[model samples]
Target: MGNLVGSWRFKEPSTVEECDSTWGSDSESDEPVAEDDSGISDSVSPAESERAPGHSGDTSPQLSDSPESAPKMKRSFYAARDLYKYRHSYPNFKKSRQPNEYRNLRFYLNKIPLVPDGIYIEEILSKWRGDYDKLEHNHTYIQWLFPLREQGLNFYAHELTQDEIKEFQSTREAKRRFLAAYSLMLDFYGIKLLDKSGNVARASNWQERFQHLNESHHNYLRITRILKSLGELGYEAFKAPLVRLFLEESLCHNTLPNMQHSVLEYYVYTIRLPATRRRLLRYARKHYRPAHAFLWGPPLKRRGGGVGPEGGVGAGSSGIRAPAPTPEQQRRGEDSPSSPSASSRIIVSSHNAMMCQDLAGGGHKGYAGLGSSMVGLEGTILMAGAQRDRNEYNEIVPL
Candidate 1:
């Protein structure tokens, strides 16, 4: 089987200068000693480490730097730091038998021949590149192919480490393999990653891809994870174009249909950059419609006597006002602005028809204000009768 590859405050370390000068001192400090990256420090001997309070005096695990049996590791502060710094490159390393993300990564880069499950990385990559059925059905391979900092669902594979991430980024071979994997996944999603221009565009197979997308709800989640992983890795530059393509397909061209509004909301939010997120939100606002009733509201008034999506009073504009009453209409004097208590008159909004229907029943309490406008969920001004829920004593109280 193809194996799916899946700040603690430390005590302040003494500076290298301090460690160099104070090495011969009589005082013994439990804190980790600092050293340059020139292998192990000679200040603390293995005999002293074994005689220390927390040591078991047994031979420590050997990390093979070469084919020959490496030196026995000691349990000291400097030793611990060394172990942490060069954790990834250690030979004969084991962590409960399951391969770490670095091992899986090495497999993919062809550094190692096969994964823990005995499947060759090339064969796994080949299957991933063309096998849509396996890609859709197999859940474990995704974490291995596109590893991220977040924990994955594959229990058989270990979580990614910072050392592993740096290794992947620094390796030329790994980056090349990553781009190939990215291109493959893009093709699977009906997107073509243009090799020459480094841009993304709709593939010729979009119709077939759309059928696959609509057939299962899991595909939506997979797309979300793919986007997140892309952003988490060094491929953030590829996100905006892909997102724009998705928006255009779902909203403008209507080619990719039946995309849930909620899923689109999350998909857009997965973009890491704030400016990119805001720009995409603006794009979505142009084409997207709110499914939530609370999010539905009238157009807001913009500055300079213009209307906006989020309601605001125009410059020098009179506040919420009741309609002008005719001669025959002034008989009841319900909405007459000419009345003595004109501020107390109920000023209804023509655009608040839906809001009126929501607050139609008599159990709600009415809140009357002179020039105050109630802002709805989408920032639209509610110029109609603003309401509040009655308290336990049946009294209207402001929250």
Candidate 2:
């Protein structure tokens, strides 16, 4: 065994005649070297092997000299070795390159099996896409589904084609499931919608099912769809509804007021479409007034005066019973004032004697006498005396 471990020395045949003579023995050797049952010596080298009986020594004329076999054999051997190595390393390689948890979640969500529960679907989709940045962060799964929600809402609202509706329904249903699961996960992680009411207001199905959803959810979905639609339209048509919804939700929930206001500011700053910024500003003014004031202060009130007193304009004082100026007052601004130099004015008078007579059948004849001294005054006058008299008279009058 030791000798076998080292290199072996063999005698070399110097000449073809010497090789043939040494290997040509037909009789078995007395030494009885190891031989197979066939009586052929297994210990003999190729050079020492004997030719078969009656065989010619000269080699047959060469037919083909193709080198393809050797190379093919070598390639096959190498390929098999490489395949074994790849199989051994495959798991580790894949594990090392595996995506993160959120990515994996998205991957699974995108392929979630469909079922009958639309609420479950919506819940899952909302859970994943409901957050401010999650939809963008896990865009791989959420992006494809978001547009579908919008489309579904639009189709449901406008009654689009069946094919279009089906397409949106499929996406919406998938997204819904994803959101539901995601919301559950968030709950498990100790994250929650601002509150139950907020959650209910924002819920996509709230209006359809008359279920309260979180307003935050509503704002999130609304803003996201608006942004997506704006992107689709090359940001040409600015939708105030989205901004308005966001502002309203923010005001209702009082969360991320700055963010909501920022959205409004973005609308005012970036959108160049006519009335787009104004509408957004109006919405922001209505709901995000605090944030707007913080950032740029309240909008400067229009300086020119028209109706009622400079700062005490109101419904009863303006004799209109509405905050907005009445049609007559609007028209009166254009009419020539009694004096050319007098500034345009809005008149707020309690019902005049004629109006009182018409409405009350002259019940309070003395009520009209109160305004007798100021009958020709161009400015508005609140008929406190007339209202008092009417109330007093009404108390005495039979129902």
Best by TM-score: 1
* Candidate 1 global lDDT: 0.44
**lDDT over C-alpha atoms for residue 70 of model 1:** 26
Candidate 1 off by > 4 Å: 1-101, 111-118, 196-198, 260-263, 290-356, 359-399
User: Least lDDT summed over 10 consecutive residues: which range in candidate 2?
Assistant: 67-76
Candidate 2 lDDT tens digits, 40-141? 121222211221111111111111223111110001122122212111211111111122222222322453322222222344444544354453333233
lDDT (C-alpha, whole model) for all candidates: 0.44, 0.30
Error of 1 at 154 (Å): 1.2
State the lDDT of candidate 1 residue by residue for 1-399, as single tens digits: 223321122232333222121112212232323322221122211211121111111112222223122221111333222222221112122222223436646866876644345555566666667677876786666666666443445655544444555566667877777777778877887889986334888788888886676555555545655665555445656767877887787667766545533233345545444345445655555565321111112222322333323343211112223235566655655464544454343433322332433354321122232112223332132312432321111111000
